[model samples]
Target chain A: MHRDGRAFAHKSSSQQELPMSRAYNFAAGPAALPEPVLRQVQAELLEWDGVRASVAEISHRSPEFMRVATEAEADLRRLLSIPGDYAVLFLSGGATTQQALVALNFAAPGQVADYVVSGHWGKVAIKQAKDYVRANVAASGEAGGFRDIPQAAEWKLSKDAAYVHMTANETIHGVEFRPEWGALPETGDVPLVADFSSSIASEPLDVSRYGVVYAGAQKNLGPVGVTVVIVRRDLLERAGQPRADIFNYASHANAGSMLNTPPSFNWYLAGLVFKWMLAEGGVEEFARRSAEKARLLYAAIDGSDGFYRNEVAPGVRSRMNVPFFLRDDALTAAFLAGAKDAGLLALKGHRVLGGIRASLYNAMPVDGVRALADFMQDFRKRHG
Target chain B: MHRDGRAFAHKSSSQQELPMSRAYNFAAGPAALPEPVLRQVQAELLEWDGVRASVAEISHRSPEFMRVATEAEADLRRLLSIPGDYAVLFLSGGATTQQALVALNFAAPGQVADYVVSGHWGKVAIKQAKDYVRANVAASGEAGGFRDIPQAAEWKLSKDAAYVHMTANETIHGVEFRPEWGALPETGDVPLVADFSSSIASEPLDVSRYGVVYAGAQKNLGPVGVTVVIVRRDLLERAGQPRADIFNYASHANAGSMLNTPPSFNWYLAGLVFKWMLAEGGVEEFARRSAEKARLLYAAIDGSDGFYRNEVAPGVRSRMNVPFFLRDDALTAAFLAGAKDAGLLALKGHRVLGGIRASLYNAMPVDGVRALADFMQDFRKRHG
Candidate 1:
């Protein structure tokens, strides 16, 4: 074993084929990452950019780290085609924390905030903000088992609402607002805030359509520790309710998200993911790939002739998460076990709903989906 | 080049001598780590513990990650010798967020919360909490430029204050309450809350000493993005004020810090650090090393005969951070440049104190301190 400056190069070469052990991981959120990004992270984990220290061990304000912070924001802006009138914040905590902060930062105390609840996470968004705002459920699909998004025309938004909030994708329920479902509600002046935690970067997005867009990086962005919040800069002028400076969005925007020490390592990892996404042709490429992967999996289920079923309305089905059930409940465990044995892992359904779920995020290659589709057919043939 | 499961072993052996590129880092907060920990992280970055995916790319609720979380909490409890009556939370966001939370969880709206201002961070704590509480500065060392801790006897105890808050050590101002400074004031039923961001785990701490102890993991624990909060279990019953469930400490304790998706990668890294600390003899060993390192560096400054100076009172000098100034302000930039060229990095002081600072956290070895002492003398000889 030789120890020299080319140690990373040596390690990379030696581990070139070890990825054979990697399964088709389908765990939702904190899901699969691009192989190239993970390999790059491994190579630089010890000595980053010749700085001779792990990125995690350095000061957030140092010049080396500042460049990382700046470049990440720039890349994300470019990838999403975000406008110059928006402020992007890279913050600690998850999307749930932001659920609370959104109300505190935009609404006056007890001011009405309209919510369009589509699934479990949408209900959670209300739970977090009810303390600071009069969270009004304008429309909901819960009565229909969250199988589809409620039509925007049926929403009863308040005339003086702080903002209209909705979830862009229901991760657990496998429901999404497809372009075929038609345009989102035109809120006139009240800004529309959407939780894009499970689906951001999977397709091209019109940033100007929403007043604010927030996503947890654990899904399509990168890692679990950092969250991205892009808000219209005009919202900074709002005289929001009494809150700590730490929870204030404008404070973070003004400080360039350096209001305090950020999750530097997580931010850097997310940056790597951003770079990878750009190299792979940004959201346009992922959009095409997502359609293909989702099509393959859904086709396998739809063609099973009562052997497999997906309950979500086809028009509103999530392209990211396709949750399906087997013909018999007794065979669920056996199917999951068999899938694991075949090197397709985490196919077990969430306890919230009993059925298998396959999440095809930006990182999940089309080959992985095809493998799962093949495995599903084989499992059904034996059971049939 | 081989692609076997022993890829980690191969990489470790191949990079055995790359420590030559590593400089002695002295940045406060996001600071240095034990090199062995970094190496282990690098080796396992791609595949961890026979799992086909990197730890960061797996579900936090997965059995693999749950085990990691459970073990990390157990190790932290053992390292701190925490009592059964205390609840530990591995929360996202830094200590500043906790500063805001402490008030919302423990103090009634508009209730007084006593604070002892020792340095920059102490003031920051007040700024975060003032909206939720009547933040009263009961004692302060600001009159003397934060060069000493306010004597406990002189503090004005608020009869109905929600809690008494203090910073255990001031990182930027280089002040601490040594044993010789006398015991902290008795607050009776009111719990004492502390910000131990820059000092926790440097030595053994009495878990029962205060009501709540919170520290950002970036400095002495493991990495950025996570904060550790230890609180008396009984205090969880306090109906302090209106707040979201995410900001409620009791909710976090009940859910085992899984109220929302956590910063799993950061938590895993912290667990690794906890293991390393245990293997290196825990807090007892770190305490001994901290004293020796502090003594050596302080001696170099004290012995420089006005070439370099530290103005903090001798009885209150911080063992973790030594902020010193050159006699001639014009030489400050040259001194930092020379130190960097000598492979001693990040000696430049924080903008708040602007001279030069060396942080000697638990991860800093005695040999690193000795080298800094040698460099100090060398620089003084050439410049003086």
Candidate 2:
């Protein structure tokens, strides 16, 4: 399973094989990418799919770039098995831009929208919605220290809401709501917009259930600059107005997402990532491996008892971001150093959540988690 | 000068290249990029500026990426010799987005805005403003067959006009305006906003002349997904809404253009391009080289008078996008076919304007232009 102690291309490989993980990334958001993906991208950097000039350097209007954009959307649609009615838009500005775009297109100044607040992204969505619509926090789990997503029944949804918004997975806090928690609380055919930024393609997603889904390309899909926006065609017609041209969903759809220049290179890389996902046997394959990785890391933390702890309940913990704390805060410095020396990179907690968090997205192999668990086991034994 | 006759970089090189652009790219917007810059990007695709992961793969929040972003802005400011009172923002969306943003942020409804309709981009600005403000095409060169800019003295500007909008360079029509053509009409104290999308960084610009200088990063700076906006600090305060988050110029300035994720990869690429420009002696060098290239191509057209013709009025033609016509329209196919075989890629003129257009931007070497001129001469001798 370990080829030269590196994760096989079967898992996430956002990086090329270097002697060590470049600076142990862990800076968060744009954290550690898989080494293999990095290598593949680097290998094709100049001549993508055998085209001269790094894909980034070419004209987006070129036939080659058009093909790259076309295939990337096609492959992504195939990997997710997206329905025919859904339109895919490769946009710029990240989830933050999507937050405002969604509200601007769906609800106007007096119209109401629903929000589910669980973590950083959820709060961001609420703040961003204030730009064009009346955003109501239908549910909140913050009082509980963000350890779990609120139960679907607990939401106070708006009967006249234009749409319901939620963060499927919060990167800052390792909390998640499974797909089974299907609570469509809005009345009058309100669209369901999910910010799946950090957790897309990690497991099977019911594309039919979502009215609009967007994920920035950084976390799991590919590199930065490119953002994937999947929206139902019907939603485009009723999208709100005084529609700012750049963020107008209808205008973008009508233009085939070429209202302005698309990031050609980033789009190409995302296409490769989508193809890579398909070749690795799709989402079920992604789930089986991702779960295995999560199970290993969680078991080590749960096994440590008082030595280490993860606050998120077992039922709702994210398979991607796993945040935990050591019993003694003073050992954090020594623990980080020890982990770095071992070559398992970016194993640090987020600033918002003081505990150490290891983000294991679709790319993280079982072996990486196994090593992390092994390292934790040794660290506790030496200092417990 | 020809390092390796047929092949630029080896097929067996560390990275793969895109095969689509087997010949040179001359599309107006995503036109020909410098081969050396493209090659450098390919070599560092896996690792950028010595950082782990392709520059695209690095997180925007990371210090490594931040350094690149800052440097890119610094380099741009340096290249343009921007003043200390202006703010440089790397935004998404192109000049199209800026068309609306400028009007939306700066002017109130019915506030008369003066516009100089030189070509397509100016028309777009006029269209966008019609929905929000009292937009007047104070001056237009359309009657001059869209061949050159009209003198500023002819503008019928309103005394209380909110701002005077103009396109510094029109890509589609191959026209440009010099700052020396800067006499104003009766517009009282209106800030000058210039859309320098096609001409930015190709020549030295007097930064103080315009209140807002916005250009999308695609043509002269970097890839798509990034737009560079330079606005005076004082002008930002004159906007209608400072809190209108997404497209409002004021908030973008207040937020340091990090209002969203900021198209990190594109921004980084822009920085790379900016550094390259600085290394090559900034826009002063670029302008000198551009003039030489334009001269050779125009000379061929002038020398062949009845054989080859350019519609643009001689004195005011663009030094970048050169559109011309062969006397024999029946020979269009033959001319294009021959050019393609000669390694001159994408020489076909824009769809709206039939014949040939060789967009010689900052990146196109004099040799490529010379090759084009020499081919034109030989073709004229054979057919004329």
Candidate 3:
């Protein structure tokens, strides 16, 4: 089960006796953490780094916590190959808050921000953006049932748009924009803001390509409270006039993300997860394994004889979230129940698109996907 | 040390061996957590309630998490004696975010929101509110060097003001609005909003008096990241038009604080804290203990003839945060260094104040205060 030789025996006594038999959770976000990271957190829960206080109890201003925060930002920057000119902000409120903040900070008064609406997240972003500025849906895939990403050529990107916004990966629809798909033609000097919540750290990314890239640290990162925001230094100048200090990116950057009391414990855990990623050969290895995991699960669905189906286009199928359906809807309940019984949990799809979704985030071991594939085959043989 | 007869043997092997010696953290916020809660978290870090996943790994939508969230809210309601008409929201971005959100939600265009500028936090709130509406300072303690809460008679209550805003306790200045100070006159219909960040859960209050009471769950509650906002149901109707979903109070209320994936682990920890509070006889006992803790520490400062002093008016001195000073300014650094060496962590005052502050939050045991008092007496004797 250990792929990177990075797996060390969990030192916590409670972790040792817990039956190694555990569920392979597939919940979308606030999802499974790397087992080692969880163990490390557990071990350090009572006393962190020989300090008497739990990481959660220490003051964010204390040197001990400041070290954790600085290291987290440094590791994230290193992992992403982020430039010195970019500010790495560990913030709260996840991507949903960022959706509004991005618009508030960048969408200038009387200026349009072009939005490429690909899936549920994109739509949500646009809805939030409209509250602050002219949120123009330059292109939308709703007409095509969000099965695929719309071509850049199809987007009527505004010539003078303040910025261009897109969801790099949509967890609900299992749609992802590959690096090539991220290329917007001839939008002169307009910054690109990407909500990389579900896909961040799952693969290598060109940090310089986007003006802003934010991800909730729930899926591939560590926990739910903290968010990783990598914003190009220059874009900070474009931050709209006099917003709430908490919502102000510049304020956070200036204060080292301790503008107010940060989610200290979450930030520390995220640092641990980042270190684990580095030790395990970085995001490149994660990309390879993530692709393989997606392939295995997709292959199971595609190979099924009219039993299982995935609607996302082959070219843009997400490598992290693989959403599929049982062709005979009647068997879905049985399939999910059996999956749960077999230690496969949270396989149910979004309520809007009901069937199943296997979120294969970085922490989701390849064997978990294989187990799901094996289960899909058995279920099809039993009912198909 | 186990005053409540609740201290259990530290069964975790790691805890059993670590020198039972630990520093007393006197951080203003992101302060101490109950020792028992930390141990419980350490024990349950990997498997929560026999579930084969860490609490952090579980989905917020999962039935198990829903129970935690629901119970947390119920216990908080019971502890605060919150009226049924109040919507208890577990949010993120801390009190700083709520300051802006309150302005965004309650400040109507062209309408003034009266702010009682008592200290640093109140002034900051007033400044943030100015961007959204006419933030009128009805009363200010700044003229008095923030030494005391202004009399209600001195407040220039605006008859048509949108809302009256105040900080129930100023952590930095160590001034608090006692119950009598909180009663505003001739502003019958105008909603009173209080930032109870540092003092919340330290005592019981008549919750129906305020339209909105918000606290960052770092001081007396649990950890950072999660903020508890208890807003009257009627004030929700006044939430201004078309705001960011995350910033909208109604959005959180309608979603039961799950508008987006909440900080689930923080929420769970907060629930544990609420249970701890209940087990320790709720806010009433905390209030009694808090008063006693403050009394002990203040006595040490006051009894030190010209050696140690606190400028804050005795009538308004905060029971949660006690900011003090060494009369011999040159000895301040030595005082802090000696305090830290004696295992009193974060005893230094905030940078702006440049002296000493001993925050006595609910989790701070009376023994910790006694130790601090004894240390203060010894240090004064040596220096004098």
Q: Looking at model 2 chain B, report the run of 10 residues with the lowest lDDT sum.
A: B1-10
Candidate 1's TM-score: 0.95
**Candidate 2 residue A279 C-alpha distance from true site, Å:** 1.1
Ranking by lDDT: 1, 3, 2
Global lDDT of each candidate: 0.89, 0.75, 0.85
Q: Model 1 over residues A1-384: C-alpha lDDT tens digits?
A: 112222211123324555547778898978887777777778767677667677888889998889889999999999999999999999988999999999999999999999999999999999999999999999999999999887888999999999999999988999998997778989999999999999999999999999999999988997889999999999988989999999999999999999999999999989988988888799999999999999999999999998999999888999999899998989999999999888888888878998899998988888899999999999999996
Segments of candidate 1 deviating more than 4 angstroms: A1-20, B1-20
Write the residue-wise lDDT of candidate 1 on B240-326 in tens digits: 899999999999999999999999999998988898888789999999999999999999999999999999999999999999999
Candidate 3: tens digits of C-alpha lDDT, residues A1-384? 001122111234544565644588898988988777776777667667656677888888888788888888888888888999899999998898999989888877647899988899999997777778788899998998899988988898888888899888999999998754556555669988999999999889988878999999999897889999999988888858457777789888899998888999899889888987887789999999998998899899889976899988887889888888888898889999999888898899988798899899988888889998999999888897
User: Residue A63 of model 2: what lDDT?
Assistant: 78
lDDT value for candidate 1? 0.89
Tens-place lDDT per residue, model 2, A1-384, is 000222111211333444423443333456445555556665655445554445665667667778777888888888888999999998877788788888878776669999988788899888877867788898988998888778878888898888899898888788877654555453448778999988899888888788999998788786777788999998888848565466688888888778777766667767767866777788889889988988898999999977988888666788888888989988877788798777555666777877687887765667768888999999999999
Q: Could you say which candidate leads in lDDT?
A: 1
* lDDT (10s digit) by residue, model 2, range B1-384: 001122212233323432344455556766555555555555566555545445665556666677677777778889999999999988877778788788877787668898999887788888766766789888998887789778866778878888999988888788888544555444446889999888899989988878889998778775666888999888877746322466677777877787767677667667767876777778999988888988898898898867988988766788878888888899988999898767676677877788988887776777778888888888887888
Estimate how well candidate 1 is docked, as a DockQ score: 0.42
C-alpha lDDT (0 to 100) for residue A358 of candidate 2: 84
TM-scores of the models, in the order given: 0.95, 0.91, 0.94
